[model samples]
Target chain A: MKKLRMSKATGINFLTYALVIIAFVVLQVMGNQGMLSSTLKGQLVPICAYVVMALSLNLTVGILGELSLGHAGFMSVGAFAGAVANVALSVSVPDTGLRLALSMIIAAIFAAIAGVLIGIPVLRLNGDYLAIVTLAFGEIIKSIINNTYIGMDVDGLHASFVQNTLKLEAGGRMILNGPMGIPGIQKTSTFVAGFVLVMVALVIIFNLVGSRSGRAIMALRDNRIAAESVGINVTKYKMMAFVTSAALAGAAGALFAQGQNTIVASKFDFNTSILILVFVVLGGLGRMWGSIIAAAALTVLPEMLREFADYRMLVYAIVLILVMLITNNPAIKNFFESTMGRIKSGKKAKGGAEA
Target chain B: MLAFLNHVINGISLGSVYAIIALGYTMVYGIAKMLNFAHGDVIMVGAYICFFAVASYGLHPILGVLLAMLVCTILGMVIERLAYKPLRQAPSLAVLITAIGMSYFLQNSAQLMWGTNQKMFPAIFGKTPFSFGGITISVTTVVTIIACVVIMLALTWFTGNTKMGKAMRACSEDKAAAQLMGINVNTTISITFAIGSALAAVAGVLLCSAYPNLVPTTGSMPGIKAFTAAVFGGIGSIPGALLGGVLLGVIEIMAKAYISTQLSDAIVFAVLIIVLLVKPTGLLGKKIREKV
Candidate 1:
């Protein structure tokens, strides 16, 4: 029975990943065939980045059962870290692809370090306090960055919170100029790169989820006291999930920076964090494929509904309310289950049940 | 000394607005187990209503204020019934998400209705500064402080003396037990939302008058600040909220005065973290053992 259960879990996961690959390949083929619009083409790279962001957020919010309102802070950290590294390394690395890849690694490393530092104090708190602290941390990071200045030169990178503190060499590249932010970055991120990163994110997340630590993390989420009684190290597991989530978010941020020239700290504020949270929640928490679909759809939906620009957010709000109502209402839930159950039974009875 | 006194007075007035808004957060949190994330947007909604009443309809400013409060009270009740009522038995996460959705809905709808352009909020009170002991105070500030004190006193009395208030108190303590004792828990909860929202309306008017920038997004920052006050004072405590709100206001004003204006927000959050680290339950919150 245990063996069968494990196989079923793997089968479900395989199907989900297969769906992502098929969708990605089909989109790629469509782009190559010149069937896709310029607008749609522009969105492809961002869709991948957002999907990765949603996936990382799901690890913390869904799997870990912690509402982190600072996922975007990690993203901001990654974006700036990667961008700074790129500027600092521009003189020697003629290969934009190599620079982008290297920056992404640096971004993920920095984000992971940040996650560990933040998670240590933050994971010790829970519920609303945790939510608020995460929010404050995001705001604090943004505020600090808003006051920061960084310049790169042959002498190396110079950073300062106060003015006139950094003496730079001739031909020094200014990566961050306080509130003005980093601009004129080389756009090296391609749809292919985003797709590869998504695959990487999916592998790390799925592998982690299948592992023992993942079970322990979810166990603690399910029942903290019960999990503690069963000898689970609550803080350690929570920190693991948070740090991994931060690392993945950093990678996504790096991809995002490569896709765009300008990256501002304000772009990754509480609102951005909440928007990502919406994707995670709307997709159904802890569901990997659901988040992929949700992240892609919601990002596209705003752009597609641009014709009815005034009513777009209004419609989005209505949809948000409706989804929550439908999902939470017992009567609505019962109806879906009954109808779905009937459809399944009508199909190849036992096989349908297994599927 | 006079400059310091001026800052203190200014802080107190600002704090009064936060205190009133914090009261709503505390009251709702005390009764309902979920944070009403939409409470902040409710302030925005109230401000818009008042702005339209005075600017568009040319109503008396006092009437406009009253109208905003009444409308917000009803809006709060309707929101409670429609958005929150169905999810009472649902997990806390669902409820929290729903509240966030409701807040978003309110904010965007307001944006759609009222253009994103900043509408001018009229000065209801005369723009005259009263000077005493080398310190100057705006009439609006004095009125705001008076209104806050009056409302706080009235609320304290109502909760202490009135039958419905007692019922609310009971409901907050134990909803199931309150219902078992023949108290209408739903009504109590609805009333709590109404009062909270009404307070938000009062705060909305005061906030806009002080800053006079009528934007759809105005309520969010103050709402968040007030929530921090509610947490600082103790989430479920009334007087705790008052004290927390006032203290937060003073700190924020002082920080802006003496520290980097851009970093004052960070300073406020830092203070909250420090407070939480020292006392997780907040200043006035009673400790409750979590059951497995």
Candidate 2:
């Protein structure tokens, strides 16, 4: 039975990998055939970045069962840190791909450091308090970034808070112009790069979820007291999950920034965080495959419904509410279960019930 | 010194508005145990209603205020019934997301109906500054402070002396127990939302009058600020909301005046975080022990 269970889990993982690979291949073929729209072509890299974001957020929200309202704060951190690193390395690293990879690594490290700093104090609180603290931290980070000015010159990088005191030489470059964010960034993030990042994120998350620590994290999420009774180090596991999630978000943020000509801190504000949360929630919590599909579909939906520009968000809101209401309704849940049960029986059944 | 006094008065005036808004947030949280993210947008809707009633229809300012309150009260009850009622047994995450969706719905619908133009809120208090002991204050500020005090007193009395208020308290303590004890949990919650929304309307008018910029997104920032105030004061405490709101406003104004204007938000939030870390239940919250 255990072997069967392990095989079933692997089956889902394999399916997820296959789905990503197939989508990449199909999209690549379509682009090569000139069958894709210019707008969609531009969105490919961003879509991949968002998919990675959703997956990382799922690690915290779904598996760890913690609602972080400031996921974008980490993203903002990573974006700026990575962008600065990328710009500083422009001379030393002539290769754009190598520079992008190094920037992402630096971004991940900075974000993980931030995560540790925030998660240490924040994880002490439960429920609403934790959510609010994360939000407060997000706002503080945004406010601080809004006042920060960073410029790179022959003298390396100079950063100032609340004052444009960076005395840049003639050939110096301003990496971050306070509220204007990082501009003139070389677009090094490609669809292929984003795809690799997504695969890496998936592998890391899946491996963690299947490990002993992941079980401890989920156990604490399921019941803190019970997890403690079983000798699980609650703080250590929560921090591990949170920092890992933040690091992934940082990498995704670096990719997202590289995909854009200009990046602003405000772009990763409360609304953006909510947008990511919406993807995670709509995709169904803790379901990696569901998150991937939901994030991609929702990201594309707005673009496709450009005709209904005014009503698009209104429709999205109504749909979100309806989905929550319907999914939570006992009658509907029972209906889905009965139908699924029937289908399973008709197929003379597979392995185990994945859920 | 006089400038500092003026700042203080301005801070109090601003804090009074936040206190009123924070009351709504605290009350709803106490009863429903969910953050109504749409409360901010409700303030926007209320402001728009009042703006239309006064600016377009030439109604008396008092009547406009009353009209906004009545409409917002009904809207709150309707939102509760349509969106939140069915999700009573659902997870908190679902309820929070639904609230966010409702917030988006309100903001977008307001945009669709009112168009995203900024309208000047009519100055009902007649633009005269009140000067006393060399300290100048706006009439709107005085009226706002007085109104906050009056509302706080009235709320205290109603909750202490009224049966329905007692029922609300009971429900907040334990909904299932309250239901079992023959208290109508649904009605109590609906009433809580009604009262909360009505206060939101008053806060909306005051907020716009002080700043005078009536836009679809105007209430969002203040709504978030008031929520921070609610949490700072103690999420479930009424007087705590008042204390938190007032202190938040004062700190924000002082920070803006004395420090970099851009960092004022950061300062206020930093104070909140420090306060929460030191006293997680807020200034006046009663600590409850967790059970296995």
Candidate 3:
């Protein structure tokens, strides 16, 4: 029975991922046939990026039981770092595919480095304090990005705090114009690239949660003292979860940057972090597929409601609260669960009768 | 040196405002055991109320302040009852997310009502600079410092002396045990929100007055900063909040003054990271031993 239950859990997880893949395939086919609207087509890449972010954040918030409001910071770092690298390489390597793969790798490396740098200090704290530090870290990254000056040239990369401090070569170009940020970034991010990233994020998140290290992280989350007493390396596991989450967020950031024409530091503020958190929570904690669905739906929902421009965010806020209510309120949860169960059973009965 | 002294005074006044807001954070965390992420938005609501009352209704500044506090007190209680009260037993993350949602809800609604443009919130304290011993101080700054000190003293007394305050402390110590002892945990929680909201109002007014720019997003940075302050001093501790707020304010001002203005916020956050790394419990936060 225990073995059966374990398999059942895995089955449900697999089923959710399968549903996501089916949806993506349908969307891709529809797009190829010119059935999807332009607005939705534009949103597809973003949906993928946000899904990666939400899934990555789940590693920390859901499984590891820590709140990180700075996931967007890691994303911004990845975006800028990846964009700069690609911009410099644009002169050397004109191949979009090569740049795409290269930038993603470089971006992930930079973001993971930042994650380790930040996670080491931050993971030492607990609960709300950790959340605040992560938030501050996100804001700090934004400020730094806003103040940063990066200019590229045949001589080499020129970086400085002062905007005019870097004297570029006669033919060299300014990659990041400080507060103006990276303008005209090469748009190489496609649905296919985004899909691979989503898959990468999903694989890491799912396998980690299923692994022994993942269980140790979750154990530490539930009761730190007990886990510590049980000889779990609490710090190591926590850092592992945090750095992994940051790295994925960075990868998503790189993809998102490549998809955009202009990227600014202000784009990755505290609100962005909160927006991703909303995705994780609405999706259901520790539910990877739920996060992917929530992230994709929420990303598209706002654009879908573009007709109600003023009321869009208001409606979004209301829906967020309502989702929270249904998920948390026992009365609502039970009612919804019963309704879902009935529909499923009703379908099963129909199939049985037909057979 | 005199300029530095003036900045120090300014920093203290700024810190005092933060301390008031941080007190709200600490109190709510102490009693409710959850971070009221909307605490900052409540401050924004209060500032807007005061702004409308004084700017539109032509009410006296003191009366305007009182009205704002009254409305915020009610708003705090209402929010606690409607949203947080139901999730008493839910996980901390849910409550935190709901608070975030509540914050955005308030911000978006305010933007819809007031628009996203900055409003020149009238400084309740008259425009006058007090100069003595080669130093200049704004009336608003002096007023803010005095007001914050008074509020802090009053809060200390209320929590340390009053019967309801004692009940709140007891509830914070152990909710189930306090209930078993016949304390009305619900009322205590409501009172905690009410008091915290009222403090947020004071902090909001002074912050707007000092900074002199009011927008829907105004309360967010300060709110986060105050939360940082609450943590810096030690979560759930009043003196910790005050001390943390002051130190954070001073650090921010000094960093901005001596270092790059662009990196001041980052520096402040870095300080918080360092402080937390050095002492995870914060300056005054007690280390609670977890039981399995």
Candidate 4:
């Protein structure tokens, strides 16, 4: 009986992986055939990035029970580092595939380093204080990026590195260019690339959750004192969770920067952080699959509602309130549980009688 | 030297505004043990109320301010009744999320109603500068300082001397015990929200008058800054909120003047991380030991 149950679980896992791979191939073929619109293709990269961000943040907030408002700050670091790598490598290596791979690896490494740097100091603080501190860090990083001058010499014009890098022709222009935004990024965000990244991220997170370290993190979430008493280093584990989350968020940011033709410092502001947080919370905390679904759904929903731009945020606000209300209501939870219980009991009875 | 002094004065004026707003945060957190993220949006609402009264109804700015305060107080009570009351027994995380939701709801609703365009606030005090000892000061700055001081004094008096204030103190110290002692927990909580919201409203009006550009998203930055101030002072301590706000404002301004203005936020957060590492309970906060 136990063997049968194990086989069934393995079968389900195999089916899930097969379906995901098939979807990836189908999407890639569609992209190659020019079936998907340019606008839809343009959005795919950020959506994938958001999925990674939301999933990773779930590790800290949902599983580890920590509120981090500075996820985007780490992302900013990753984006700049990634952009820099891509720029430098594209100049040196003539091969596009090799350059892309190298840039991603560089982005991931720098983002992970940034994560550790931030996590070491702030992970000890718990609850809302943690949230506020992270938020401040995010804002500070954005402001610095906005003010700092970047430039390179092209022809006779001494183009600011930032402007030239963003494809702005420098004549001492205030281009993103002074808050106008960075344009002309290489559109390397293919559906297959995004799908593979998501699959890898999902697998890593899943394995981590199943591993001893993940259990230890969850133990801390369940009961910090009990976990500590059992010789678990709560602070270290929390820091680990935060750093891992930050690295994932950074990776997502790098993907976002490269995918979009235009990137702006203002786009990664406090509201952006809050929006990502909403994805994590709305998806059901501590549940990885829920976050993935929520990320995809929420990303698509706003774009679908673009016609009602003014009402979009208002609707978002309402959905947030409604989601909280429904989730927290005991009656709704009980109703769903009872229905599932009835179905399970009926199946058990039928199987028993047949046996 | 004079320029430095002038900057200091400007910092104090801004700091006082932050202090007033921070008090609302600290007070609500002290009693409810919930971070009222909507408190900042309540300030935005208050500013709009004043704007409508001044622009639409043509009321005097002072009267508009008073009306806004009253409306904000009532709105606070309603929010507590509708959004927070149900989650009183829920986990801290639930309430925090709910507050965030409420904040987004409030801001977006305001946007939907008022449109996203920046609205101009009528200047209550004339934009005349007063100079003394080679330092120049705006009339609005002086008014802002006086207004903050008066509000602080009034809050102190209300919380110290009034019956409702005593009940609030009782509730914060020990909710169950306060209930046992015949203090109505719900009423006290509602009143706390009301008073806190009123203070936020006053700060909102002041901010609008000084800055004169209002948008739906404007409350977010100020809200965040005030939240930091609250933590810096001590989350549950009122006077600590004031001290933290003043200190934060000064540090931010000085950082902008001396260090790169871009580094101001980074420096402020660095201070927060350092302070939290050393003193988690905050500057004026008494260390709390949870009864396991």
Candidate 5:
């Protein structure tokens, strides 16, 4: 029975992977055939980026059961760090794809460093306190980025905070101009890259969730004291999940930034964090496939609602609330489950009766 | 020296507003165990109501404030019933998301109702600065400080003495136990929301009076800062909220005054992080022991 259950879980994972591949192929074919609109085509990379973000956040919020409100802080760190790496590498790395790949790696490393630093003190707290500290950290990161000035010259890189003291040479170029962020970034992110990143994220998360450490993390999440009594290292497991999630988010941020001509610190503000949270929550927390669908649907939803103009956000908010209420309602959940169960059983009963 | 004193006064007044806002957060979190993200949006709505009442309709500032509070009280109860009540048994994260949705709903509604334009909040008090001993203070500052002190004292007394307040305390301690003890947890939560929203109205009025800019997004930053203050002080502690708000305000002002202005917010949050690292439950938060 246990082996059967394991096979079932793997089967579902395979289904998820298949769904992604099929979707990618269909979209690619459609794009090649000129069947996709420009707005939708532009949204594809961002949708992937958001999908990775949702999945990463689910690692922390769903799997680890720790609420982090500063996921965007890590994203911003990755974006700026990745953008800078990409720009700096332009001199040495002549290949665009290679440069983008290296930049994402650098971005992930920086974001992981940030995650470890933040998660160290932050993970010591529990519940809302943890949430608030993450929020404070997010704000702090944004503020620091807002005041930061980075420029690269022949003399190497110059960075300053709260002042424009970058004495660049005649050929020096500004990488990050305080609040203005990185401008004229090479649009190196492709839909294919995004798709591959999503697959990579899924593989990492699935393997982790299937591993002993993942079970330990989930154990700690479900019952901290019990897990501790069972000799699980709470801080270590929590940090592992958090830092991994942050690294993945960093990669997504890098992809998102490289896909755009310009990236600003403000783009990864609290609202963006909340928006990603909405996707994760709406997707049903620990369900990875649910996250992908929710992220893709919601990312496209705003563009689809462009006709509503001013009321777009208002409608989205209402839909969010309604979805939460409906999904969480036990009565509605029971009703839906019963109907689905009956539909399956009825089909089986019909086959038996025919036989 | 004179400039420093002025900054302190400005800090105190600003801190007073944060204290008022933080009180609402602390109370709701205490009772409901959910961060009411819409609390900040309620502050915005209150500010808009008061703005229109006083500026557009020429009502007395006091009357306008009262009207705003009344309206916000109803709005708070409505939001709690519609958006939050159904999610009572849901996960805290789900409730939090619902609260975020409510916040977005309120902000967008405000933008749609009142065009997305910043309106200068009228100075309720005349343009007069009170100066003494080489120190200048605006009347709004004095009024705000007085109002904060009064509200704090009243809240402390009410929570310590009133029957309803006792019920709220019971609910906060353990909702199941409180319900078993025949305390109406739902009504208490609703009342907490009402009082919190009413305080939000007063906070909105004072916040705008000091800064005097009214926009749909005006309350959001301050709301976040006040939420930070609530956590800084201790999530559910009233005195902690007051202390946290004042210290945050002072630190913010001092950071901006002495350090780089742009980095002040970072400094303030850094201080919060340090404080939390030292006392994970905040300055005055009681540590709850876990049992398996």
Candidate 6:
């Protein structure tokens, strides 16, 4: 009887995966046939990127129980690293596929390095202090990007190494026109690429959570002293979670930079970090599936409400407060639990209690 | 030497404002153990209140300042009752996030109500300068310094001597014990927020008068900086917040002067990182063991 129940559950999980795959394929086909609007197609890249960011951030915030506001700093580092790699590789190879793959790897590696550098000192601090330090780190990175000078000056327009590195010679300089942002890069991002990335991220995160290391991290979140007494290396697990989340965020940042026709430093400001954080919190922390749904829903919500531009953020703030109130209310939680309990009991009674 | 003196004056003035704002952060954190992220926005709200009082009602700047403080005190109490009281027993993170949500709500509401365009704060000092020895100081700077010191002294006196202030101190030390001893925790918490927010209002008025530029997001930078000051001085230590604020302001000014102006924020954060690494409890914070 237990085996039969297990088989039924497995079948349901497989069906869910199959449906997701089918939906993705349909969307891709529609997009390629120009059945979908370009605006939505353009938005797809960011939506995918935000999903990676939100999920990765959940590792630290939701799983490891740490508040990190400097995720954007890591993303900025990754974006720049990826842009440079793409530019350099194009100059040397001039091939599309190899450059895309290599740049993503390079971006991930560089972002991970930055993650370790920041995590060493920041992870030592707890709570609001950690949050403030991370926030400062993000702001500092922005300030540096704004002030630093790099690459060529052509007709009063200055280009950076990222833009110029790809060109065979003088053309490379045309790529990153400094603060003007890199333009005209190949839009290699497709529905397949995004879907594959999301699937891989989900699989890795799921497997990690199911593993001993993931359990250790979650245990640390529940009770740090108890976890420590149980011989869990609290610091090691926290750092691992932080670095893993940073790497994922970095990968997302690379995709975001490469996917867009134009990129600017200002786009990845403190506000962007806060927006990503909103996704993690509003989704209900520690719930992976909830985060994914929240990310997609919030991403699409703003676009749908674009006509009410002035009231958009105001409404978002209201919704955020409302969600927090509703989710944390004990009365609401009890109501849902009791209703679900009754339904389950009714089904059990109808099916026969002998099973 | 002259450049150093100039930086010193600039630092002290900035520090004075930071110290005033940091008091709000430290006070609220002391009693509730919750970081009031909206405290800075409250400062912004205070500034706007004063702006309306001066611009719309045609009141004197002094009267405007008092009115702003009064309004902020009431708003602070309302926030405590509406948002914070319910989350008293929730985990620290819940209250922290709620504070952040409130911050965002207040900022966006300000933008929606006042519009996003920057408003000019009228300069009350009228280009007056006071010279002492070889150095010259703006009248606004002198006034701000004097105001900060006077308020600090008044607060110290109030907290040390007054009945309600003593009750607040007792509550901060132990909420349940204080409640058992017949001190009303709810009223004490509300009063703490009121006093803290009123101090923020004073800082806001001084900030606007000195800079004369106001925007909805103006509170964020100063807010973060003041929070940093609060942490640097020690999260719950009032005098430590003052010292830390002064030190932070001086460091920032010096960094802007000696190093690249762009790197001032970076340098301040680096100091924070170093401080946290060396002493995680901040400069004056007492180490306490957490109970499992």
The runs of at least 3 residues in candidate 5 whose Cα sits more than 4 Å from the true structure, single-residue gaps closed, are A338-355
lDDT per residue (tens digit) for residues A212-249 in model 6: 99989999989988999999997898888888888888
Residue B48 in candidate 6, Cα distance off native in Å: 1.7
User: Candidate 6: where is the Cα deviation over 4 Å?
Assistant: A1-23, A29-37, A93-97, A152-186, A331-355, B290-292
| TM, every model | 0.96, 0.97, 0.96, 0.89, 0.98, 0.90
- Which docking category, incorrect, acceptable, medium or high, applies to candidate 4? medium
Computed on alpha carbons, the lDDT of every model, listed in order, comes to 0.89, 0.92, 0.90, 0.80, 0.93, 0.80
For model 6, the local distance difference test gives 0.80
| Candidate 2 C-alpha lDDT tens digits along A1-355 | 9999989988999999999999999999999999999999999988998898899999999999999999999998888888888899989999999999999999999999999999988998888888889999989889988899999888888999898999998899888999888888899999989999999999999999999999999999999999999899999999999999999999999999998999988898888888899899988899999999998998898888789989998988898899888888677678988999999896665445542
- Encode model 6's per-residue lDDT on B192-232: one tens digit a residue: 99999999898998889888889998888899899999999
Enumerate residue pairs that collide in model 5. none
| Candidate closest to the true structure, highest DockQ | 5
**Over 4 Å off, model 4:** A1-38, A151-182, A307-309, A331-355, B290-292
- The per-candidate TM-score of the B chain, in the order shown, comes to 0.98, 0.99, 0.98, 0.97, 0.99, 0.97
* DockQ-superior candidate, 3 or 4: 3
- Model 4 steric clash pairs: A150-A161, A150-A162, A151-A160, A151-A161, A152-A161, A174-A177, A174-A178, A175-A178
Number of backbone-clashing residue pairs for each candidate, in the order shown = 0, 0, 0, 8, 0, 4
Go through the candidates in order and give each one's DockQ: 0.67, 0.80, 0.66, 0.51, 0.84, 0.48
Instruction: Give per-residue CA lDDT, model 4, range A27-100, as digits (tens).
Output: 67888899987876677778788888888888888878888777777777667666655655555786766666
> What DockQ does predicted model 6 obtain?
0.48
- The candidates' interface RMSDs, in order, read 1.4, 0.9, 1.5, 2.5, 0.9, 2.8
What's the DockQ of model 2?
Answer: 0.80
lDDT of 5 by residue, A118-169 (tens): 9999999899989999999999989989989999999888999888898999
Please tell me which model should have the higher DockQ, number 2 or number 6: 2
Task: Evaluate residue A59 in candidate 1 and report its C-alpha lDDT on the 0 to 100 scale.
Answer: 98
Q: Point out the worst 10-residue segment of candidate 2 chain B by lDDT.
A: B279-288
